[model samples]
Target: MHQYVFSGLRVSSEFKFTIADCEPFDGSPDVTIRFVQYLEKPLHPIFADEIVTAAPNDVWFCASGDLAYRVKDGSEILIQRGENVPDADVNLYLVGTGFGVLCLQRDLIPFHCSAVEYNGHAVAFSGESGVGKSTLAAALSQLGYGHVCDDVCIANSAQTPMRVQPMPKGLKLWDDAAAQLNIAQGARVSADLDFHKSYVNVDRADQTGGLMFNRIYILDNDIAPEFSIHELKGAEKHAELRRAIYREEWLHFLQEPRKTFDLVSTLASKVAVFAFKRPDDLSRIKESAKFLALHFDDGDAE
Candidate 1:
C-alpha cells in the first residue's frame, strides 16, 4: 500500500506513482485507488451506451484502450487497467482525467489551469490544452514562484485561507521548453508518441496550502495580438469559468447541473477572473511570464 497526499486528500494506491508528492497519512486514507484486471461492465443501464457518464456522486468510464475507471462518491476509485498497461499513460489518465472526475464528484471546483503561488496566493492560468499554460507556469517557477499544481486546480480547499490544492509533478512542458528555460534536467514522461512533452520537477511541493486562491488568468493565443491582461465581469466571468472546467467532457453526464452552477457562481464571486491574450509565438513565453509576475507579485493583478 502506497500513500501520498494528492489534491488535498490522503490517497492510498495499489501501485506506486512516480510523481506523487510525498506526504504522510495517519489511520486510513481519504481516498483509495485499487488496481485490478478485467472490469466487468456496470450491472445497471445508467452508462451502458456511452464512453463516459458522470452522475451526481459517481462517474463511469470505459475508455483509454482497455482501461476502465469507476469513481464512487469521491471515496474510492476502482481502476481496471486491462491491456492499457503503460505506466506513463496510466499515471496520465489517473491524475489528469481520473482525478478531475473525482474532484467533480467530491464537489470541488476543477479549473483547467496551471496554478502557482505568488506571495501567498494562488494565481491560476486557464487556457486550452495547447495555449502554453504549463509552459508559462514552468517559467514562473524559474522566477521563484512556487508551483501549486499543474493541469488541475482544486479550488476552495476545505482547509484555511481558501487555497487550491497541489497535484503531483508540476509543469509538464514540451521538450523544447525544457532546454529553452534551462531548467534542471528531468525524466522524460511524455503522454504522446511525438515525445514533445516532458514533466519537469520545477515546482516540487514543500508543503500544501496556507495561501488563498486569488485570481484566475484566462489565455487565448488567437485573440490577443500582444500579451495583455484584462479583468472579466458579469456574464463573461461566469461563462469563462464554465468554459474552463478541467476534463469538461465528463460534465456532459453530470446529474447536478444546478449544484454545479451554484458552485461556479460562488467561485466567480469569491475571486477575480481575467482574460489574457498573447500572439501564438512560442518564443515569447519568458517575456509573458515576466509580465504576469510584474502584475501578480504585488497582489494587484486584476
Candidate 2:
C-alpha cells in the first residue's frame, strides 16, 4: 500500500504504477488517491477523448482506463483515474480549469494571480499568457524578492485579515526565458507544454512567511512603455478582475457561468488592482517590480 498526503489530507492504497503512467506530485492532504473500478462517460467536445467527468463529487480525475479513489472530508470519494499525490502544508485546491475555486467553503476570497513576497507583503502579478507574468516574477526573485507562487496563488480573505497560500515551488517559463534563467537542457516544462515551457525555482534564496498582497499589476500589451499604477474601483474594476481570474485545467465542472462569475466577483473586491504594460524593451519587467516596491513604501509613510 502506498500513502500520499496533500494539504494534510492522506490517501493510502495498495497499487503499483509504471514510470510512463505517473503524474507530477502535488503535496496536499485534501486528496488521497487509489485505483478502483473502470467507468466511462461522454467526452467533452473540446477536451475530446483525453478527459472525462464523473458524477456525485464532480471531481474530474484523469482518464486512463484505471480506477482511483480520492479521500477527503473523512469520506472516500473515488477518483476514476489519476496520479500519486503528496502531503501539502497549505490546503487550497484549484477546482476547475481556467478558473479559481477553493476546496474549502470558508469565507475567504481567492484571487487568480502569480504572487510573491517582497519586504514581508504578498505582491500578486495577475495577467494573461505571453504577458511576461513568470518573467516579471523571476526578475523580482533574482533581485531579492521571495516567491510564493508563479502561476496560481490562493488567499484566505474570510479571516479577520487576508492571507496568501504558498504555491508549489517553481515558475513555468518560455524557452527563451528558460535559456535566460539557465535551466538544465531538455528538462520537461509543465505537464501541458508542447513546445516552449520550463520550470524555475527561486526558493534557494529565502523561503518564509506568506506575504499579504499589498499591490496588483494587471499586464496588458496596449499600455505605454513606462510603468504606472492605478487603483481599481467600482464595477469596471470588478469586471476586469473577473476576466483575469485564473482558470483550473479541469474546467468541465464549471460549465455553469453563474458559478464562475459569482466566485470571481467576490475575489476582486478584496485586493487592489493595477494595469501594467511594456514596450518592445523587456527591462520594464524589472522596473515594474521596483516601481511597486517603492510606491507601496511611499504609501506606508503617509
Candidate 3:
C-alpha cells in the first residue's frame, strides 16, 4: 500500500482504484473528468447509478441502492472507467476526486496558476484560462524549471511567508499547445471531454533548485507587446488578488468571507505583480521564456 500526502491530508492505498477499467457514466457532468477512481472502495457505493437531471447547477448523482452520492456544488467532478486509485492515509472516496477538492477546502487560499521553483521560493504564473498560464509553465519546464502545480495551487497565507502545496503532477494543455511542447500523442491524462492534460515530474527536467517568487507576471493579451513590473497598492491590488484566487465556488463555504479576503489581500501585498504581453509569433516563445528567467534572476539578486 502506498500513501500520498498533500497540503495536510494523507491518502492511503486502501482507497486506490483504476479508471480505465471502471464503468463510464452515460450522463457525465459539465466538467468532463475520466479518471474517477476511489481510494478505498467506499464502505458502500459512493455514486448514484441513475442520472438525476435537473437544472444544470442542481444536477446530482447517486449510486443505485446506495446512500453515497455526488452533488454538484460549482466544483468539478469526474468518474472514469478502470482508473487506478493510489494508497493513502485518508479513506474518503472523493479525497482524490480531482484538484477541486483541495482547492475548495476552507483552510487554503488556492490560486489558478502554474507554480515552479526558481531559486528557493515558488514562482506562480496566474491569469485567465486561455491566457497562456500553462503554456508559459511548460516553456519554463523545457528551460529546466521544476513544476509544483498546474491549474489548482493551494496555499496557506496565515504564516509570515505564505506556503503552497503541490496539486497533481499533471499539466493541462490545449491540443495545439501540446504539439508545441512536443509531448507524445499518447502521454496525456484526460481532465474533461474537450481538454487533454499531461503530467511530468519537475526533477525529470535538467533544472534543479526551488524558486522563491520575487515577481509575478499577469498575462495580458489586450496589451501591446510590452512589460511592466511595478508595485501594486490600494484597492486595485486587492481586486487583482481576488480575481487571481482560484476555486471561487468554495468561497461561500467559508464561515467568514472577509477573513479569507483579508488573508489573501495580505499575501498578494507581499508579492510583486507584473503585466506581460503574449508574443504575436510562435517563434518568440523562447524569447518570452528568456525574458521571464532574466527578470526573476535579476530581481532576486537585488
- lDDT against the true structure, per candidate, is 0.75, 0.51, 0.52
Off by over 4 Å in 2: 1-29, 36-39, 42-110, 181-186, 190-193, 204-209, 248-269, 299-302
Task: List, in order, the clash count of every candidate structure.
Answer: 0, 30, 44
Candidate 2 local accuracy as lDDT? 0.51
For residues 163-214, write the lDDT of model 1, one tens digit per residue: 6776765567777787788866566675457776776777543544534776
TM for every model, in the order presented, reads 0.90, 0.66, 0.65
**10 residues in a row with least lDDT, candidate 3:** 83-92
**Tens-digit lDDT string for candidate 2 (1-302):** 45543212243433332111223344543443344555344333333334444333343434233332332333344434334332210111222221133232222334556766766677777776677877777777776767767666556555334556544535667777656655443434434336566555565323334446546778776757576666677786777666565553333443345765666565665666777655645645566667766765765511
Q: Residue 119 in candidate 3 has what lDDT?
A: 62
Q: lDDT per residue, candidate 3, 13-126, as tens digits?
A: 223432211223333323322233441232233322243322322223332222222323333333422323222111123433243443443445667777667765678777
- In candidate 1, which residue ranges exceed 4 Å CA deviation? 43-50, 53-56, 157-161, 203-206, 297-302
Error of 3 at 45 (Å): 24
**CA deviation > 4 Å runs, candidate 3:** 13-104, 191-215, 249-255
